[model samples]
Target: MASSRSRRVEYDRFIPFRSAMDMDYARFALTMPSRPQRDGSRESPSSVAYQKLLDECILKNRSRILAFKSAPEAPASMLPQFDEPIRPQKKQQRRIPREPERVLDAHGMLDEDGLNLLDWGSNNVLAIGLDDTVCLWDDANKSSKVLLQAVEDSGPITSISWSPDSTVLAVALGNSVLALVDPATGQDVNVTEEDENQTPVLSLAWRSNSILTVGRSDGTVVDYDFRKDDTSICFYNGHRRGVCSLKWSALSGRYLASGGHDKLVHIWDACMPVSHHHPRRHQWLHRISSHTSIVKALDWCPTRSNLLASGGGRNDHCIKFWNTVNGACLKSIHAGSEVCALLWDKNKSELLTSHGSPKNQLTLWNYPSMTRAAELSGHSSRVHFLAGSPLGGVVASAAADETLRFWNIFETPKTTKPELPFAKFSVIR
Candidate 1:
């Protein structure tokens, strides 16, 4: 009975089995009987023996029920709780605004929307205007007004050219007629017998006092001689496409270069003039098949007359310099965008090209070396035209963004470092 009491005390101590060892022992006792029977009968002894076994089984089962219920009610501090909610942090975004473009002027400022720019002969003057009105201003005279104005054409004038002497100004009208006006008198010459085919004159160049070359969209280069009064001069028709650019060399007056939509730069000897009554006798000097796109602009270097620069066309972003004598590409510069216009600096050693689309960028390059010199960025749209002053003081650029900007090239400060304070001192402190 003392042993039975000791066993009961041990069992009771482990009544609430919270650990795995206690629970395993409890399961083993429930599955196996505590005592074996001496009789041959499979059943256990009856009465007191059965009651003792029944009581032990009931106690063990009751303890298991109590432990399962109390296990869930234990303090949460003893174990980690997975049901806790978490909050996330919010992020902040910053916005940056774009900056507006600004223009700088060294001498004077002109109003916007002025197109068709021309630098007058030898004088520090410029002519610009729209429709029938033209304004000429002297850069030397601050108080001077428009030097000349004329209403010479009925339709809007599409093109303007100054004669070699800068005495006569020729205006090409939108209606496919040409008018010659005197800049000093603003009077139009009545030389108005229009060509029957009358295509819009795309470009104009003055070859001499007697001959004026006009390029049309019909791929015809016509010469109008002021010396003859009866019929028009000879028309040279070799370009199978519309003429986009024309240049007459100042060194060799007979050599004429024209670029067209056919992607070929045709060099013609204008000296072999054909009479209006006879067939054309002009000989093709050389053809440059360098540009793969339409040539929009061509400029002959004043210092190096044999070197010619041409640029423009869709997706063509290069400026090519060609030697007219041999028809070889001397050098090419990648402008990284479609080159719309090109101008040689007054010194003829540096070339400036204006690119369009993606960005309006102006790039200057050392001519024969093709090395990048500088890049000017300010325009917001496609730069369509660039004109450099003969005096090398200023450069004027026009863009589709409805603004004209004048860059003062002469105002660039020299890169000499300032003298040190000690170096400038005399013998005394």
Candidate 2:
């Protein structure tokens, strides 16, 4: 064992320097002495001799002390160098454009240079065109050629509907008349011609072989039957505003669904037909007042006629599904932006919607399940329209960017065949 005094001495000798060498050495060398003694004298020194010795010490050591005090700090230069090696910046990732799954490039078929409306025929052909001209395309063969092109009076074609058998095409034009044409021969049937006073026929629906329903922007729904020979079987004046959408139910020929700018959906029955003279010929079935803005589009489930879906002009930017029989809302699907177009998948269990301003996004959802399956965000603008292929293998979307996008929804493997009399639902936002 060592003594305490010796241990203290060892600690002092071995201890590391507490400060930089410049600070410690400069402090020691620059300290001033209290007083100085005369040469070989044991008595108090004279003031003059003390002054002289003090001056000499300061002058001799001043340069050496300053050199030590001004020494450069190593840590200042080393910190930045150490940081550079430890944390390097990362490179940003870039997005690549994808190839379209299918393209519909054939021209001279749609109404004008651009397509205004499109509908699928019973035979899987696409019926589309601008005012007064209807063209049909065989979807299976890219080069199959235009199957039929029917030309009517010179006016903008607002809407088109194919007969259930795909044999007849009903067209509504700005001329305020409805024309039925044979798709196989491009022959005009000349069903009815009306005066220009009943202007802007916005929507048309074929109820049966004998009856057709026409909804006008002036808020009138007219039922014209060929069996009656040009007679207006029913005239609906209940819509307080412009009618935007119309549909005839396969389940009940008398039950017609109409949506309008009034943000109300009115169900009319054909069992009781009112004349233009009778102010109350139309009977209102159920009115849906859920939409806050003008209801842009609506569709009854083809398989489940009782299930109805509507979209557009909602504050939440969502699509609502309802039980048409009971007028009860079944489910609502939330989307990132206002849904511009809504379509039902071939399975009838899923819904496809397109959104985004300058509209470029496409999303798929499983119905009732209300879960999103996929999101397609490649387009830079709002998607204006969407159409699903009859075979359920593909979807086509149009945008204001002057481009069309084709999506392959059937890229995933399927396990079973879809059961029919399919009651799939469709909604357009």
Please provide TM-scores, in order, for all candidate models, with all chains considered together.
0.63, 0.63
User: lDDT for every model?
Assistant: 0.65, 0.65
For 228-255, candidate 2 gives per-residue lDDT tens digits of 6646876776787777777777656657
Candidate 1 per-residue lDDT over residues 1-429, each given as its tens digit: 255544432344646546426676667777876532334465556765775676587645343444555455468798887888886777653221122132422221222111233434445555554444455655566333443343455445455667777777777755677777776777776455566668777677788855788877777887787767743666666777777677788877867888877787888776665656656546467887778787766888878878788885556777888887788888776667877777776654777787777878777777678886667777877776676655664676767665656666422323578888778677764
lDDT of 2 at 43: 44
Clashing pairs in 1: none
Q: Compute the lDDT for candidate 1.
A: 0.65
